[model samples]
Target: MSDLPPSVRRLADGLRRLPGIGARNAQRMAIAVLRAREGWPEELADAIRAARGNVRPCGRCGFFAEGDALCEICRDPKRDGAVLCVVETANDVLPIERAGVFRGRYHCLGGKLSPIHNVGPDDLAIGALLGRVRDEGPAEVVMALGTDVEGETTSLYIAQQLRSLSVRVTRPAMGLPMGGSLDVADALTLGRALQHRQDVGA
Candidate 1:
């Protein structure tokens, strides 16, 4: 790293910060960007900056949006407002949307309830989720989170919290594994999971 120019090394470090990027990959990417023709790197940089500055979380659903407006999904007039799908992070939203099985709005919890990790109801978007339930009055909320221990705990907690509300809580069934993340699941699998959903307590 010391042998490389300071700017190149810095670019590599920046690339490494992205998810799934490792040392070799970041260095390769940095080298490619440095060797690219005029205007390409500047375009990438400008796009990155533009996204960082303009993209904001949707106030109602926690998905990414431009400015203070709701995300495209939440703003869609044809989406099934009566059905809401809840997931752990904004990344999880993309896969479900790709599956194209659900035409409802979404709520991103940001994370799961992990007692060992010191994450609790307050740490997640539970309050916002409850508020959405009350305000939007969705007839059902599908917990599209992972199937791990933390996910289970969060699911049950959410079900309990919404128990008093006149809403049916369910989870994707069949296709997902015991410790699967929705982001990594295939589109067909996710579609099947949504199609064969099961009630939370059942």
Candidate 2:
């Protein structure tokens, strides 16, 4: 790394900072960018900067908000206000949308509970979720969280919190395998899970 020029090395380091990108892959990407047609890498860099600068979290659901208003999902009148689906992260929202099963609003919790990782209920968007539940008056809150232990812990905690409220808290049904990630599951499986969700701690 010390042998490479500062500019090339800097690009590689930046690439390596991205999720799932390793040292070798970053180096290759840097070299490829250097060898690509004129303005190829520059265009990509500009787009990344633009998106980072403009995209913000939705004030309502915590999803991507393009402007000052609520996100598309939150603004949609056709979506069911009686139900709300909660997920661990923004990434999980896309998979559920692709499944095309849910017609309710969504809330991204930002992350799941993991005491070992020092992430607690306070670390997530639980407070905001509770506030939404109170304000929106949803009939049911679907826990579209992951199947991992941490996800389970998070779900249970959320269910307990909402127990006193009038809303019913439930989880996606059996189609999702235990310990599996929601993002990796096929659309069909996810749709089925959403279609037949069961009450949690009922």
Candidate 3:
């Protein structure tokens, strides 16, 4: 049984459920929140609630947005629709955006194909991706997926699907940490990696 107050213990338990947050870190964060001067907890709760309520998947790319329609990036006219970058998740968009090397639009796959977890191509947004590619008629599709087995598998599948299309498919040049999440990579590293992407074969 936890000796902390019910509210504090509840918050700690909830925090612990988050990825990378252990019991000790959760307890520390809970204590820190308890020590805050003003309505920090309220602010945090409001932010969480706002995100949960307002954020929805973008219609074109599967990125998170405040409305039921497309996200800001996908809606922007200045973005290069002729080139699309395929990534694993909505969060993965941040690092690529930060790199500023890609002026193109994005296609979030929701996740990589994981046969072990029973997550197959059907489970991902592959159909939507194919539809978007066919409709948009992009010149190129840049795959910014991780270098893990699942990532490679997903990339190959996407490349295979695009083979009949006129669009060129490519993968980022080596340099990114294998099996690493793009969300955590430095901007410069990612930019360099993007600048040297290699063509994917048919």
| The candidate that achieves the highest lDDT relative to the unseen native structure | 2
lDDT of 1 at 27: 96
Model 2 poorest 10 in a row by lDDT: 1-10
Q: How do the predictions measure up, each by TM-score?
A: 0.83, 0.78, 0.81
The global Cα lDDT (0 to 1) of model 2 is 0.92
> Which regions of candidate 3 deviate over 4 angstroms?
175-202
Over the stretch 96-183, how does candidate 1's per-residue lDDT look in tens digits?
9898899988999999998789998999999999998999899999998887789889999999999999899998775887697999
Rank the candidate models, highest TM-score first: 1, 3, 2
In Å, residue 15's CA in model 3 sits off its true spot by 1.8
Q: Compared to the true structure, candidate 2 yields what TM-score?
A: 0.78
| Of candidates 3 and 2, the better by TM-score | 3
Supply candidate 3's per-residue lDDT for 152.
90
lDDT of 2 by residue, 151-199 (tens): 9899999999999998999987758888999999999779988988889
Best by TM-score: 1
Worst lDDT run of 10 residues, candidate 1, spans 171-180
lDDT of 3 by residue, 64-114 (tens): 878686899988999999999999999999999998888999999999998
State in Å the error of residue 22, model 1.
2.6
